[model samples]
Target: MLRGIVEQEGISKEKLEARQAQIQEEASKRFFESASQKASSLETMTLKSPALKSRRRVLDDYDSIALERILGTSDLFPISYLQIGLNAGQSICRIQIRDARGRSLGYGTGFLVADNILMTNNHVLDSLETALDSIAEFNYQDDENFMPCPTHTFRLDPEQFFITDKDLDFTLVAVKDNPSSEKQPTDFGHLQLIPTAGKILEGEYVSIIQHPKGGPKSVTVRENKVSSIFDDFIHYLTDTEPGSSGSPVFNDQWVVVALHHSGVPDPNKKNAWVGNEGIRISAISTYISENYVSYSATEQRILTKVFPNLKPGPSSSSQADGYDKSFLGSNYIVELPKLSEEMENDVSRMEDNNYVLDYTHFSIVMCRSRCLAYFTAVNIDGNQAVNIKRSGDSWKFDPRIPESVQYGNDLYAKNDLDRGHLVRRLDPVWGDKAQQANDDTFVFTNSSPQHKNLNQKIWLDLENYIMQNAINHNLKVTVFTGPVFRSDDMVYRGKFRIPAEFWKVAVMVRDDGKISATAYLQTQKNMIDNLEFAYGEYKTYQVPVTSIEDITGLDFGNLYLHDPIKDRETIGHVIVAPEHIKL
Candidate 1:
């Protein structure tokens, strides 16, 4: 009983009962007072309670039709893409000219057609006919095993030969049956042979067949339209490359039209297909019909199936003679578009061979003049076309910079990467001016070895900033940023090379009464550095954009401008006091 009372039951029943009653009474009084106060406060309350809300528009900005089109289009179009010297099945052929004794004469692939008789360029047949009296030989085969050159040779009938055509590319030969000793000629299906006289309309779809080096060996087809046509020649806008020569061009029906011809000797711009041209079939068809013998049953059957109901088409687009205006100040330079992927790959391979260096894409103009320098993720199109060298006591785009040295001073520097440009050279233009923009564009200090992602994103933003803010205001700016040190081979070096992916962007702006500079050295993924190195603080170093441009002889008027910073200010210039450099 005593323990129960001690355990909160009250020492004694009477006292415990009294204490509990007293506590209950006091609690009720306090509760009533508190309730009254809360009611009064609620009646007098003014501020509203917080609530969730959303904007009215959600799907307004989207284009349903465009989205559907992109998602629904069929993929049949990419099949027809072709390059030169390649065959209809996207394979290359080996022209084997040999004697009856199986002695070899010459070897090459088919190129352009001269007349009705099949014609490979003269260069292809040169070795076979080196000595006219040397028994004429002919052997032909296709690229089956990806070998650089074919081994075995079969004799070609001397009677198969006709005098090669002049002016136009033409070769006449009698069709012959396969020897009992060898496998039958590889069938490339039927080749669509369209006459040049066929309706050559501007903007009409066309296809090509050829084997491209380093790509597919089977016949590949691609489609494109005629950008423009000339009286002397026709220029279509389809993408083509080396080894595509001798490839056939056709209409949608797969009827052969023309032969893939040549490309610009050298290219420096991006996506480097400097526009593909082909040989007109009309120029050589008459000669082929008159001199070459008829195809065998097999050949005839193939042709009939491939070119059913083939007929002459008209010159659809009017001749583009009167419209051939000057691209820039009477310089007869052909206005080739940016480089194509195949061309870029070729240049990259060539650069690996030490034949040239390429850093062609436009980059930021960080700092110019005597002490000019900049950065980018990759130096593009530098030496792929024109020879590039480091200007003495000056700065310009140089293709020979080793990858290591090119992207040094940053943790992410390496080889085989692009040093992209934040600002484009063509963005700035005085007026309706069209030129190479080389003096302004071909500067090295405006680059930074970049990854494909950030280069296309943040770098593009930086370009937009300069273009909208600076150039529009007539304020000239120059920027410079690039990767660290690495190899010099543009192609090989790009494979394993690291990137000073750390973009150290520095911009110099020249405005009224002042010069300004600002910089941002950061990454897209990690806001901070992973290792022990403290993130290099962004430092804007500037003197004057014009002063530097004057010293360097670069024209910055054509550079796009963008100035959206909070306050216009100057970056540090190399201001050595008169006596600062002296003893």
Candidate 2:
């Protein structure tokens, strides 16, 4: 009976222990299954979290090789805000395209590349003729009160010197200076054009300041990365709107890298995109280098200053289109040098179909850009010297140029300067058109800003001395007078340049059939600051014909060798009075 009880007890204990072990195993398995499900849910949430992943992964489908490579470069060299001070608020101008009826066509943006030159898109400016009719408004921004700021408006130059390229879709034009003020494009500053290749790389930051959708100036900066670079175009994410057509696309350094043109879809399929395409600036530089000859030397100098790497354009003489030398008459002692290369469309034609050059005794060899030379027929014998003149005879603008371009009375107001005529009123006052020629002498283009002293004292004496010779010789003489227009002349009021020197070339037919030439040069530098005509302050030199030709860029037709001063060591003599002058 005792042995049976012990065996039963052992078997019961073993059964209890086995049951507990099985329960523990079942609990352990349930706990693990519950934990695994929670862990799986957490993993799913983390995989979808943007903050926890790499930026590359966040961009997801934008991982194409081009974008990937670009992003990689951007990733390595982080975009930085470098400059905001240099040329920040001075370069931009608001443009309005109008029709012949003064009707609004559209609005766009433009910036200065050189002094007096504004650049925009051809699509914005259609044709060269359209640009001349358009207006450029500067300081077109709102003040703190949300009121439109006071703006300066200027019309385009009548020179109508336009160079456009459809491939680049660019229009470069010359804007007129402020007619009433001494303000110039240089006062506003300009963007430095960089033509060196590889200066702009893909994945660099580009910040654009523009007048978007024809609205006030706005700037776009965030996420504005250069996505890709084609041969001539750059695709960026710079967020530009419609009216931003010609706004300069600036890099982080504020240097213009391209011109904002068109935009495309974003790579992420985010349904968020804008016009972000630009014609690379390098391409524009190429066009400029080829077409620079059409511009004036002053214009070219500005371009060269802005772009040191620029090459010279093809060589061409001054072009004066749609006009001939007949205005001066072929009966002269010799024909004036033909403006074969630098010919510009005649200002009369450029102005209107009804506008006539209507030249009388004097003619203008108008350089399409600069009216470089003026010629007048002088009849010493068959002429009446009309003294019909008034101190109040207003300086009228040349109808040939738009109001914005004419060098009118604004430059002389309150300044002791005189509007000296290239073709003196007396010289051309002999024929039936005496009054007309006298009236024409007042045209701003025909006159330069002369020091009152020099114009009254020295310059007048020289003209009188020459006219006196007309009586000694025949009534026939031809005179050509103008400024020696240098690219870097001293600026007045920041816009007009008072030429330091004036030159005159007078031709006469001697008693013998031989042609005699005399060249005169007068400088007014010492008298510039003096309001009075101080004696001994002016120097009038009877320079060699070679010197005159050298300074005026005029070919005198073998007259340099025939000058009285041709063989002198000193090309000229300083003449204070008529007696001091050598005819």
Candidate 3:
């Protein structure tokens, strides 16, 4: 149960205004104090001998010149400026979010900083599931003479990649490549991330081209300036509106410096706006650098561009990446199911892996026995694009996980068992990096041994049916799957141990915010016991989701109450067919 809101003493409007004014005054005083010190030093130097004073003035001029070089000159609209805006426009995108009926829900903005990767505010796109129906329109602007601009549209790729941080108010996603056309290419002429801090200075002129109120793109070329820089935020005097939530805040060189999120009221009594608050690009780079794993050379190169200092190896934990369980709608952590004390013994929870794979829709926890807990998502996109084709990437042990803990190919040799995907190969294949996701499913940690019939027939169909039919349940579904380890498991030629039964618990978030879940168990008892060279007979059952909690000792986080068979007395006995699913 949620606790009531904490009540604090409220201050009068006058007191609130006074406190805000004081804060502004203090900040202004600090800036001026430094300026005053510089002025005093210059005055003191001027009082010296003429030659020495002139020498001091020369040094000051040199300092000004150096500052100009770093911040870029405001003296003239240089040729570089035109190229900057042009390239930025190609990268900038207008985000339009809509509801189920195709009516407009709202709009925001975003920009591509690297290949197929776009950055925006978390509030704009809380998750790829929500972003599925949201359209990302590129080059949605007016021409030089205010003529209609050519544009391209790309869908959000939830299956490929998605990561977001709420404290930073930023979301990074990989969008589909644009098709071949006269309008645009797959690549958006992107801006390289600022390599480090001090790239954007306070009071420096910053540019922002955005679709305000979902209108055509408008640029704040001459009107915007960086007001302040905080640990995670950059306050800038950029003109924005309701539809500009995720617009990129760029420096004069067209380098993306921040993501404009919300406007703040001025402290003065004029009742005017001061500046907008934005999540710093550095914060974004740091988060993505630490949390998300790159799949291919292209993604690796882009990751290097966005996070130049990122090391080659994987991070220790998402917590090491400044993880907050509450952020991203508590997407990071997979809560252990509510189980009795007897269920807690001997269960080891694992999350860290070589993939840096704790993302919006999925995370993997491999046990010491080589099998894993795979948490994956199914949403509206998953329902449509469930047909993502597979590639022939060779299965390999993930370097980040202990090599000894994985079931390698040696286990399948000279046996009736088949190497199966615990997370299901088709489940993660959605979005821009669909190929990469397909490749990821081939990792050894995600594989288990299954009877050929179980892999090809009942088990496969059970998952396929749920993913397809659960479309009615809002498509924002999360699933957990793994093999159930028992002491009497089959020993494969003394090299590997294969379990007879495997379990899957699928939790779907209904349109009304309630969870709907179904637990399934598949066993190959008949096939493995026969010891004959024939196809195995497999049985798949729909068990109560709570039953898994007792056996796995992991919590499913409010998903138990949602089990369709939770209240049924015949649970674990009543079998469900694809057409007869309770969904």
Candidate 4:
């Protein structure tokens, strides 16, 4: 009976053990499932942030194989062509096109190519079509009589396309024969296409010829880098716009590599066209070859005209293989020669756009963005003064002189009417040290409106006089000058600053009583001529140094002036030098 009881207990124990094992398996599976779901949730949360993910994908996509493969060849190298603004008196050709409808539309500009063919984006033609279909009147700025009509017959490349799927948007058209005696075709010449034979390394310099969407269409040249490549397409993180579509992409060699397609426009940002992609020309080389078989003569002619200087096929790579610290993103580059030791030394002390000692005039000035203003930097003169002279009716303090005015809490010119410094602030001083401050000094606030002619002529004389006089006499002069805004109640960073009724400048001297100054009224470009004819007398007058204080209402009482004076140094003070001492 005892043995039977033992056996029954052992079986019950075994059954309980099996139930616990099953429960443990269920718990393990549930834990793993919960962990995976949580991981998925975290990923979804991360994708919710657009700013973080937008640029992130571009960088990552560059690592993919498809992008790497396409940009890896010498056949896919980039080329760039330069563009000059039309306003600068550059030579250009206007192309007019008409579609099935007879209505007129806007015209397009043809970039110079070597062959007889002219090049423009396909969309330009489409816009011409829409205009013709609408029977709209074409508006032109330069030639009012010029109307939109198909002046040149052309053929669109069958190889070109508007891609929606794996879209590589580009349209290549052939140039037609033009009659002689017409406006010379703007055939700057053709550029060699970049080859795609080698790997396009990251951060490579790339440029594009883009058309900006605006009143008059223009070809804008911009440069950037190959941020990433993906699925047979390379993405450029360049600034492009809607009208830039179907433009050409080139590398440093000035060769055409890809056809510009589309971009991601940042609606919230101005002038922001991001993610411009291009159709890899190498990918469709066969199509280009097959379609142009019938137009071989035309293709050859176009090629010859576009690139008279080039032989088709892969060209030598002028592109630098490694990092170039000297190169910036390719939009603009400074190519100024190195400065002299003296200029370099002084520039180091000032901010970018900050004025250095005007050796011509004994004063300092700041180059605020668009405007340039003068500051006082005077010193004591020890020698006895002579050659005191005057030219006007009488040496009197004229408070009404425009130079006597002040603006934005800064008193610039006290008696001098001529706007003094131009090209203020030495950019070289800051090289790389706190560039923003250097840039900020260029603000137009630091500048005053000055007559361009006067700046180049009479003002130039005054500047030279100051520089020569200071150097010759060993005189230390102080100069303070700025602009006079229209409003008396002006704001410097939102706080109100009072200004004088008219603009003027004041120069104080340490030498025996001789004061040399000029003053005049401020006027716009149109009114400058009239103001000059009226106030031109002020430009020739020479007033006493003591008269400056009375006119400007500024007291520099008992202060010794020096160009570079040590602390606690005293130059004896006396009344303004007599009329004879003023030079």
Q: Put down candidate 3 lDDT per residue, 290-313, tens digits, no spaces.
A: 533434323444566656665434
Deviation (Å) of 436 in candidate 4: 64
User: Higher TM-score: candidate 2 or 3?
Assistant: 3
Cα RMSD of all models vs. native, in order, equals 35.5, 27.8, 14.3, 28.5
| Tens digit per residue, CA lDDT, model 1, 496-516 | 333333332333333333333
Q: lDDT by residue for model 2 over 1-583, one digit each (tens)?
A: 0000111221222442343344334423433344334321112333334422332332325334423333343443222232352255467887887766676656788998877778777666646556766888877788779998777888886353455665676777778888675566668888778775554555456778788867887777645556566566776676776677788887544668788765553335554453357788878787666544434433455556657778644322112121233322464345564332333343323334432233445555443333333333233332344544543354444434454545667777886788787777677665454544555555565677788887888789888877766645434667777777667666677676667788888776666555667888888777664444433466888888789777766676776765777888986787777887655
Give each model a TM-score.
Answer: 0.29, 0.41, 0.47, 0.28
Residue 219 lDDT in candidate 4? 41
Off by over 4 Å in 4: 1-114, 118-167, 177-183, 194-196, 214-223, 230-232, 266-272, 290-583
- Go through the candidates in order and give each one's C-alpha lDDT: 0.34, 0.60, 0.61, 0.33
Predict model 4's lDDT versus the native.
Answer: 0.33
Evaluated at residue 326, the lDDT of candidate 4 is 21
Candidates arranged by lDDT, highest first: 3, 2, 1, 4
Which of candidates 1 and 3 is the stronger one according to lDDT? 3
Residue 366 in candidate 1, Cα distance off native in Å: 84
